[model samples]
Target: MMKKITIVASMSIVLLTTACKTKDLKMKEDRKEFISNKKEVVYQVFTRLFGNTNTTNKPWGTIEENGVGKFNDFTDLALKEIKDLGVTYIWYTGVPHHALIRDYSAIGISNDDPEVVKGRAGSPYAVKDYYNVNPDLAVDPANRLAEFEALIARTHQAGLKLIIDIVPNHIARKYEGMNNPNGVRDFGADDDVTVESKRDNNFYYIPNTQFEIPDTDAPLNGEKNPLVDGSFKEFPAKWTGNGSRRAKPDRNDWYETVKVNYGIRPDGSKDFPELPAHFDKKSAQEHFDFWKDKDVPDSWKKFRDIALYWTDKGVDGFRYDMAEMVPYEFWSYMNAAIKVKNPSAFLLAEVYNPDEYRNYIRLGKMDYLYDKVETYDKLKDVIRGHSLPDGLSDIQHRMVDIEHHMLHFLDNHDEQRLASPEFAGTPEKGKPLMVVSTTISTSPTMIYFGQEVGESAAENAGFGTHSRTSIFDYVGVPAHQRWMNNGKFDGGQLSESEKSLREFYKRLLNFSLNSTALMGAFQELQSVNRDSSWGYDPGIYAFCRWSTTEKLIVVTNFSWLTTSTFELKIPSSIIRKWNLVDGTYELTDQLYQESKLTLNVTHGEGRIHVVIAPSESFIYKL
Candidate 1:
């Protein structure tokens, strides 16, 4: 009897273990399913300004006076609040070490000459070290990289990925990689400075020209620095970051940086091998295989190693600055190598030329490119009342082939703030524009820090003035501070209007995150409704997005004073695609559930009447 009881108990334990294993496997599968289907929403935060509580508006203020935010400032509560905004990724801009006018000689970090730097903080694009984090952003300067790694771990723990910048086209005028690993030499260390261009040289020298500082009315902006004596020693000046082949670059040029040469000669001829014909259609792994044994430039190898090093340290991806300035072949080799280490690394680039979009995405292996020239420009005009909302349909039609590869943003560090007088003059105006930009296609949506709470960037911070946030100075973003609430990250100090706007953003963004239709097929409904009895006008833009199980109807009213009431028509083509029968279906607003609307389908046609206020948008579930 005892032996029979023991056998029965052993059988029960085995069955229970098997059941638990099956449940865990299913959970993993579900997580992967959600990751593959959800649309990505990226929150871009300027690393220095995100958590600064200093209210001092001193122009050209030093870090101690203005107070800089540290990596530890991104506390768990702070990251959780950001993740709760429906953000899939957090892009920490200015994480890499850059030239700044601070005396860090105690830590082996040489102070940058004010004559060669942009502002007190220096430009984030002017990278001084690729293998190290900005010392200014660390609580303990000696453990700067470790602090950044801890932040990376915290960000991932909050279920959000992290992205850092990689300025591969150039480096700080005085480059120094203090944290470079063994056997990895610094950029331009072995350069033959006597030649105009060499196949293996990291930089292109002007042969015999000496570097001359650009003439400026206010040298060092009146800052008294011994090094700002209108002299910076450089033998055989290299080309400027903006491809200016001059010994003394123009004041407006990227004079603080020296350009990296990727085997492209000064005469516009390729010194390296070009990608083979039809190579654009190959996968990243295939591209990786193709370049494994190919002879590439030293600059290319250095960048690839930098990227891989960051990846091994838990960096999820990189945002390539001025990507178009570099050769596409170099990107193919560099991005492919990154993919081999981490297949899902996010590779976003700033390629403004619309003509080179496909070549950059396909051959360059970039996952996303800025949709600035086409979509962002059109939307900017529409919001400024310079263009009708109807023009968005034409823009969307042109880029249908590569729509998903585009990333949309209403404001970035490079653009004016929505609440600034130079822009729309009110954060409310961004409602319709944000709705259109975020849900217009299957592209990723990006929101700059302080955008949600309406940061006007009104301070006249030395290097960069009003209209845009100053990336080149030690400063604080006021409206964003209200949201940060002294690192509570709970929007405790925000005004009612600011809170309401942030809530609107939260709802729309969360909807986009969970909705399958957002990442599915899209069709414009404006052209069909323009002729209908619905009184559809150019000020109104409407569209539809649907998948096998979910369908959405989105409409926006761009006029600031006009409240539009229209009978939006979903034509027979869309109705057939959606497979709707002749019945009345409830259409609920996903953004604000204030409107009671329904779609009436009759004989293969769908119609719904919507009343949208000025600067209002409706994302309806049909």
Candidate 2:
């Protein structure tokens, strides 16, 4: 998990004269419908902190001290700004009821012991109640689900889809469905606790063994819990969420929640029905039809119902956390059911195994999976000087079969910040990496909210030390807070450089969302230039993306400290395909048009003279 992706930077800013003050103003003048091949841009906003105005980033801070962002804070204007960023989907993380240090017993919700929770506000993955919403996100705790529903409505009204998390692998240690519909039953409600494993039992419990609190350091003991006596008793200890069989898991383990038993017995034999050979690449509707009368484990049905409940409430998709850990057959059932309800739903997963990528997408029915282990990791090596830019071409070559389903990203809540000391140390270092990440494939692109503005997670927010933004603490993100400008939803408080970096992201993302060439054809020019006689530097990565109507010759510099001028050649074969005439032509960098690049053509080979800034990219269109 420690091995990860890092920073980016830009060449120059390209400001459109028609750029209006806000999204509403710009849309009225320049907005256009999405074309046939434009990529979907997913903007992941950590829901709890997106609109928080507080700057006091106290470690393990309480909601009152750090201050919590509300559901209503994602106003119509805020949603529009995100929409204008060309985002098709908004992954609203931390929307469900999780194990946090809060008391909601008065409203039929049971309390989670502080010793079992992860930060002052526990991880969003540990669901305390599947039927309710996180009360901390609501202006009125009693109306939390209503507030989230309203946020969903606002997101759609602003022309963006909403994606929430569906963590099926585990539930909170204190799992209780406080608001389950009349016919539904909470997990473990009908289990026979004496048994260690049963095909239909919701949990794998250690009979007669009481669960012990992990011997973690005190700051995270979480505000004087009456249950922190280290004997937070469970008569029969359930298996820890990370699949640790230990009744007392260590602090380093996923000790916050318990894993749900999906009928995978201790011997790893499946009790549920397996997918047929023909179901491998079948349509979701086909999968749905296949499972219409089949019987599944109770846990599988519980999760499918949860997904459908949200879809009925207008939520368009889901981002499954640690999806590979869950059984494939369950996903075959759940995803197919979800698709039956909403065909275009965006279903993404955090799957790291390259070997299992195709299985998860084709058999598991996942729409997208993380490219973190492939191109993303290779890009990091290029930046850290561990490898050359050509390594990226190898990743592309191997992923050719499933390239479209691979999602590209430079930043996410789980990764280090673009400006973190552990990464590239400045927001200015993110532009070039971002350019390649966005344009290299036809897959969807995602950017964490603070990523565009270069949010350096210098604050030691609770569970996470630094580098990555804290998903488990109530801390305000510094750089993002500046962009928020006390709920103004404008970058009025950002530094000059921060503002410019944001402008670069805005232009780049907007272009990616509207460019047909990006979703058209991808031809690797890195190898061509690397083996060229004119001497191309290893820090430079060039490629060609084109459609019948649009063609882009992209060149990106991975060197953070060296500026270079080089001849980026557009190959003879490519030129012939474009039917470009044999002549000298002046081409403009579509991203930063201040300088004009000269392209010379002779004997079908075309060469362009370009001066690339350190850690910046040039997107030239003719």
Candidate 3:
């Protein structure tokens, strides 16, 4: 009986231990699955500049023309290329229809001008109708909805997300019915004005009462001459004829985009011209009310419906163009409404000014905004052969400042390319610098189209009224080989410099994707001593990213010359491993018998990489 009792006890103990081990293993597997699922890489594609099915002809027809031959299907062609790059998200730029009116007489046309007939008609930023998809981009006419659904389905199948562009600011300058030469019909303070003021025009004018700008030697309205008057002018008070003066034939007047008046007008008429037509506290609510329902002008209800239509079709997110120009409340409302349909949908805003962070993200609830400040300052400095100060302490501080809601990039469609000598100096020097900054920055990195290949910024690529041309030239090819044909300017035909940059980008991207430590939030390691070059060089930046389960240390050499004899002290509690990404390194035992890792960087070619090892960080364990 004693032997039997002991056997039973042992059996019970074994069973309990087995069950506990199984549970722990399952939990570990679950965590790994979660991390793997959350990994995402977004590839930006300028639709007009990307490859076209018809190589003989340009992708864009004319500004007024639609349904040009062999449209590039979003699902069939573009998404395939993105997936080939191992990217999980596709951010398609400027899919909406732009202005239709030809302003050649006013803006003056050049063959190389982006707005000219180089590719398609219309600027994607100048949205003509918010409620409709440009037919040119549509894959099927009768089953347009089906096509969009299929595209989303394909993206999901291929493990990718689709993000489209949304323009909430001023609509196309020549939006239909808005081009009426006569006074705006339904916009004034009247009950029976049935024309719907919101739909008739692309912009909602803000009345002058909300904010005030000092009147300096500001340019006069309608007059080419500069104002010499020293006296200040109440905004919207000095202007005449609804204050709507055509600044240029192609672009709308500045007053048209100014915020609406939120205060009560002195005349008691909401249509009082004396009030600066800015979207202020008072008029915004009314405009919101007017557009919330289908009854208001420009059909805000229809716009909402269009958004819903796309969301229902399964678009993952939207890249709102010129987001700063719109009201914060509008975005808040839109974001909430969109989230109701798709909770995980990403909302990215193209905000030029970083000062509007409070309005754009804090109050607005946006997911991400372009981090132009870091890209322009610290990143640019590194590429220009400037060493970071004190173990990149300054860079780390700046990174932390915008860490919560920042988007890092080496180049975007709006700026000059990093490959350009003017901006990046030279590809050989700039490529590695760009790679290091992108990898170590405290935000998810974004690679613009052709950036991997170090494509230089064309003359018309920057902010302009012209239609963007294909950054690469793709002409000739047989009829059957038309679709994504191996044309003259394929990805494989990159220049030597471009090829080097591309490989470097691929390495950085692969490193980020493979390592769990580099994808999420990280802590900057504080240096114990200030005398070391790693501690003082403004160019050498390093940071550690650690989750509860994983830890990673990323170090970057931003200078053109080799950095030698830099000492990095590791805590005795952590296990250290030395691996080289761009150069050679040796570990030495130093003070306190702790291992010291020394890295020898190559001249003009620096290293940027993440070191993943257990118990590596001083403060936290991953």
Clash number for each model: 0, 7, 44
Candidate 3 residue runs with Cα over 4 Å from true position: 1-39, 53-81, 100-120, 135-150, 177-303, 385-402, 432-437, 458-491, 495-500, 519-521, 525-530, 534-538, 561-565, 569-622
What TM-score, to 2 decimals, does candidate 2 have?
Answer: 0.93
Winning candidate number (lDDT): 1
Local distance difference test, candidate 1: 0.85
Which candidate do you rate higher for lDDT, 1 or 3?
1
| Lowest lDDT block of 10, candidate 1 | 17-26
- For every model shown, what is its TM-score relative to the native structure? 0.93, 0.93, 0.61
> Where does candidate 3 have its weakest 10-residue lDDT segment?
17-26
RMSD for each of the candidates: 14.6, 7.4, 16.9
Ranking by TM-score: 1, 2, 3
Ranking by lDDT: 1, 2, 3
Angstrom error of the Cα, residue 137, model 2: value is: 0.3
lDDT of 3 by residue, 140-183 (tens): 43343344456568777767787888765544423433222233
Off by over 4 Å in 1: 1-36
Tens digits of per-residue lDDT for model 1, 238-345 = 899999999999998899999999998888899888889999989899999999998989999999999999999999999999999999999999999999899999
